[model samples]
Target: MFANPMILFIQVMNSLSLAMNLFIIAAGLTLIFGVLRIVNFAHGAFYMVGAYVALSILRVTGDSNLGFLLGVLGAGALMGAMAFVVERGLLSRLYDKEHMLQLLFTFALVLVIKDLVKMIWGSGQYSIGAPPFLRGAVNLGISPYPKYALFLCVMGPIIAVAIWFFMERTRWGRILRAAREDRVMLNALGTDVKLVYSGVFVTGAALAAMGGALAAPRSAVDPGMDSLVIIDAFIIVIIGGLGSLLGSFVGALILGFLTVMGSIYLKEWVIVASYVMMVVILLVRPWGLFGKADEERH
Candidate 1:
């Protein structure tokens, strides 16, 4: 399989594209966990909803390139608004409750959203095509790669840099980092930590939806899609270290290669390989590869 240079190069490109796609989804997850301390099981459901929303928009706009842009933006906006309301009215009430209650709450959200999705879009699967501008292959000297795949490869870093700039360079970013360290102290300093939490939740949820929208062109839009992607998102975050954006990025790359290459080499045994790698990483560093020695949020 590795003998052909052209084939090997294309496979590497595939892995990079996959990694970026996964990173987009997992980034929000790690952010929410890092700040709110909520292991949001409903995140996957949010992603599914985004794809469906995009699908509906595409139906209305009839596949125009402009329509695709609208679909992605609309999906993010709608999901973010819904998340803001949910955060304020529901999730906020349970922030001080037991962790199990929070877990159960998010799990319940998953069930509710899944049912609503089925009711609205039916239980069938739908596929979305890339926009006209992003269709066809681009010549990359050694190999011609799909335009959409290359788009994903570029998007991942652009997003990472944007988020990093927000987190490290902005006042709000410092506030979030402060909240991660000691939210109570930040609150006592008159920071209105509740608003911060709500904002984080909304932004995180929006990112999940946008990731879903961006990903819809490459994958199926189905009711059960969340179940699969969420597992991958968790693995990426866990392997890279929960709540660390850098960790999620690195972790995504690791899993991307493992998944792409492992399928070629290990085939039927590929699924087990992921968990085995996770277990080994845990044994060596429970906090994850980029997780801090003192990663616990106050």
Candidate 2:
């Protein structure tokens, strides 16, 4: 009934947990788009890879917690390496080309990665158990909360904070920001813009992969996951304003809360509600909630 505040609270937490994962994926997409000016449709493929890697390692290692950590780290490293190759080997060649061409190349990558995953793992759903240490539940006033959900809530913010610190406080971060703003100026100043681009792509891929790996225990890894995730993530990136980390966080919260509320009330229209919100936001603010139009031409 309306009197149960606990139910509402539990739902809020659930939405936030989902938003955290979305934020991770959107953050990477925003950064890559902001700097390299490519949408990297394959980002979701990297996310799927994370889940698959986590599932495989967990089964092989037979250690839940270690598997979790290794899954994240291993997926990040492998995806980063893959992205590095794509950026340095392929994208670098298309730097002077039209945006549409670059996007089409990434689009082709999406299909390749999807089939590769299916070929290697088959088109089946897979999952791993939560670590024994986090196998219990904590009762909230509204409903019992899974320990795994609580752990995710905590880790998500920590990651957000860490990324903020790296982007705002480090020298490398400064160089990257400058590259985003003025690639020609950066290159003229003796910076290797190609290296900068590669670095950004790899970092973004790693973040997406880590998010996927972290989520594997909570959800099954399925073949359709890549494209399924890209749609939602793209909405988040667009609503948050391209290239803004803080925007990504806020957009994630908005979409997360909306989905949770809508699912509870209008379960059939949950997906529709997300896109509807995106439409409303775009109609009102084309530049996005936090993103400004880029002045630099590629």
Candidate 3:
């Protein structure tokens, strides 16, 4: 199957697109885990909700780049605001509680958000056509490839760089990193740890939502979509190493390539192939490819 150059090129491009999408979502998951020490099970729910919200926005604005941009921004802002509420009203109370409680609370949030989505959007699958400028295909010497997929290929890295710059260059980003190192010490310096935590959670949620909104134009928006992406995001995070942004990017790329290739070669066993790879990698390096062993403390 790899003998065909055109087929290989298209699959490679597709994998790149997939890797970037997974990175965006998994990056948020890792960031939340890194700072708040909470495994947000509802991250996927936010992703799903973003897609639905984007779809609604697109319906109102029609087929234009501005419409897509609004959809993505609106979805992110909405999810971020919702995250603020969740962090303040519920998650705030659980900080001193057992890890189990945090897990259960977030898991419960998954169900609540899913049901709420069902109520609002029903169970139907919806899709948005690519913006006019992105609707066609690009000639890649071998054959034509989707312009939107190419756009996604570029978008992933742009987002990653932006995130890196934000974390590395900004004062709030420095505070966030400091909080990750030691919240108690950060608080002692008169920084509002609570506010920082809330901000981190909201930002992470917004990134997940933005990822979903961006993906909506490429795939169908439907019920249970959150479940699917969440599983993939978890796999990426685990493989990349919890709390490591670089790990998330590398892990996403590995999984994306494996999944795309496995679908072509292993057929129905593609998922098993991914897990097998994970197991093998874990056996070799328990903390993941770029993850540090000491970062596991909660």
Candidate 4:
């Protein structure tokens, strides 16, 4: 099997796409957790909504490259605004409350979002077709696969770089990073803490939503997706080291490769194998592969 270089390369490409999607969701999650100190369980809901939004837009706009881009951006903006409302209207008040209460509130949000999606889209599985340009495979002299996946693989790192640049080079990113380090001091120094929190939530939610949109063509959108995506996301977040963007990327790649390889080699026990890998990672490096302890230290 190893002799089939094309097979190996395609599998590698598949793993990369999966990793990219995971990174998109986890990047937002890490940022939010890094700054807000709240584990927003509603993130999965945001992702689900994104898939639905993209599906709807694509259905209306027909299959085209422009439609896909519009669908992704539209999903991002819509979810970002929704997160803004949720953060400001509901989660904002719970900031000082206990962790249980905070989790409960987000948990309720998960249910609410689920029902809302069902009501709007109905409880049915749906998928989007790849745009005309992305329909076929880029032949690697072996088995051909979808070109869209390759596009996703490229776009993923471009996005990651953009996010890193924003966080490290821009003033807003600096302010956000500063807020993550010490909200109390930032507030004391006259920075508007509430606004910063809202911005972070919106940014994170937007990325999660876009991830859903990007994954829509490859995966079906349905009711159980919220729970399903969240579980994978949780693993990615934990493995990457909580609140570390770079960690999220690394963690996603590891899980992506493990899942792809396991499915190919251990089809009967793929799920079990994946979790076992996670267990080993956690046992050896509880803080995650590139994650440092005390992430909030300024």
Regions of model 1 farther than 4 Å from truth: 295-298
Q: Which pairs clash inside model 3?
A: none
lDDT of 3 at 296: 56
lDDT, candidate 3, residue 120?
95
Candidate 2, superposed: residue stretches over 4 Å from native: 140-143, 294-298
Per-residue accuracy of model 2 over 1-298 as CA lDDT, tens digit each: 2467787678888888888878877888988988888888888998998888877877777876776778779889988998898888888998889989988998998899889999999997887777877888987655889988888778767877887888889988899889888899999999988888999999999988888887777877899878878887898888998888888889988887888788878789887998888888889987789888545333
Report how far residue 152 has shifted in candidate 1, in Å. Answer: 0.5
lDDT of 3 at 92: 93
Cα lDDT of model 1 by residue, 147-171, tens digit:
9999999999999999999999999
Q: Evaluate model 2: give its lDDT.
A: 0.84
Give the lowest summed-lDDT range of ten residues in model 1: 289-298
lDDT of 4 by residue, 1-298 (tens): 5898877888898899888878887888888988898988999999999999999888888888999999999999999999999999999999999999999998999999999999999988887887788988877566777888888888879888998999999988888888878789899999899999999999999998999998888888888887888888888888888888888888889888888988879888988865786788789987777666664353
TM-score of each: 0.98, 0.94, 0.95, 0.94
The per-prediction tally of clashing pairs is: 0, 1, 0, 0
Candidate order by lDDT, decreasing, is 1, 3, 4, 2
| TM-score between model 1 and native | 0.98
Report the backbone clash tally of model 3. Answer: 0
Which structure is stronger by lDDT: 1 or 3?
Answer: 1
Better of 1 and 3 by TM-score: 1
Listing every candidate in turn, what is its Cα RMSD in Å to the true structure after a full C-alpha superposition? 1.2, 1.9, 1.7, 1.7
